[model samples]
Target: MDIKFESKEAERQYLKERLAAGFRIFAKYGFDEGPAGHISLRDPINPDAFWVVNPFGLHFALIKASDLILVDESGKVLEGGANRHLNLAAFMIHSAIHTARPDVNCAAHAHSLYGRTFCTLGKSLDITTQDSCAFYNDHVLYENFRGVVLDEEEGIAITQALGDKKAALLQNHGLLTTGGTVEETVFWFLSLDRCCHSQLLADAAAAGTGGATKKIGDKEAMDTWKVVGSRKGGHFAGRALFDLIEVETKGDYKN
Candidate 1:
């Protein structure tokens, strides 16, 4: 069947649904807390604009597709029923990525426990398992911790640190992932979160009874990416994930 969004309302609704899906998945994996953390998508036709972040202070479990605020690449609100202002750090962090990397249509960042733990250690996420392997040689490390990213300058610094990597571990902050599309970015974050969790578990096990060291070979890193990139899902999968999330959340992202 051919699905077409023939009207602006339809397109807005479609985008809203996709945004809602991102929220649900993040919530499902416990990547959010209170109002912290955010996910954003670039406007498909314009490189200088993007969807506004869902207002800060909302529960991830309650977000809906329609509650997403529309914003320009400069973080100015364009549409949606959300509160006028967004979280300062999110605007600084997300807007920078959107502006600097036109290739990245979707960007997500969160203070998930595992990701936060790894970020605090000042260590990169080593490619130890298949899950973490997708990020092998593909993550950037941002060591500048300038408190909360509250301005365009900090945002620019974050973007510079992101460079060409699809993922970045913000020192003393959290994890960030970007992609050519929302699906890809969301999946990257999901995978990154899992990878961090796995490493933590392994670390715990190693220190459990005896001082056993967990080591992953160089070849294992290459092997991990091989397994991950083998399958290409494209746009359909991202839209599907969004639609599924819309159904699950019942379109309740406001409050």
Candidate 2:
């Protein structure tokens, strides 16, 4: 278990494979609303100014390791087939975050059903459920939704709004989650969207005059977060999902 990678090439292979797997995972969960979402990974060989992203307009379910396009901080496509092009929002927002936060190597953003609904509230998630504890005091709300994030300035604003959090709820936009690894980022995106769905249902149930929701105490929530929200926890949570997806696709995503 202590073995991380045999070499830099091995590390690169794993990261790219997981990056592709994250896309398929998102697609299976209904996170792909056309070309509205993206997952980026810091090129293991070039962690500073380069990253890998899926080609624009490609369906999440069909992406593979070889299909990812490498781009520089300035958004120029450096690799991927001749058909490769950049996703401007993916490049703008992700490049800013990758630059600002060297600690984060992976970021996943999507316009999932609940994320769209919950972000409209313009507030961070409330630690009312055990599962929501993972994000207790650990995520931010970027309430400044100035249309689509298609420019570097907008990306910078969103990054500033994110500050040092691992995830963000972009108001009127959607949810964005980042982590040190692909597994962690994908897991947070999955957990966050589900949490948003839970909140929506809970809100409907408590909409009456006297139906109030119970929230977890600060100490309790923080304690639970230590177990469920850690980087290692998220990675472990992804193992089952990844294993299943690989089997379902017959290891096609690893290509």
Which of the numbered candidates is closest to the native, going by highest lDDT? 2
Instruction: Give a tens-digit lDDT track for model 2, residues 1-255.
Output: 144898988987777888888899998999999988999988878776555556678899998998888888878787764567778888899999999999888988999999999999988898899999999988999888888888889999988888888899999999999998888888899999999999988888888655978899999999999999888898888778888898898889888
lDDT digits (tens) for residues 106-128 of candidate 1: 88999999898888888888666
* Candidate 1 residue pairs that clash: 52-69, 63-253, 64-253
Top TM-score prediction, candidate number: 2
Candidate 1 Cα outliers beyond 4 Å, as residue runs:
1-9, 209-214, 229-247, 250-255
- What Cα-based lDDT does every candidate model obtain? 0.75, 0.87
Cα distance off (Å), candidate 1, residue 24: 1.8
List clashing residue pairs in candidate 2. none
Error of 2 at 180 (Å): 1.0
| TM-scores vs. true structure, each candidate | 0.86, 0.95
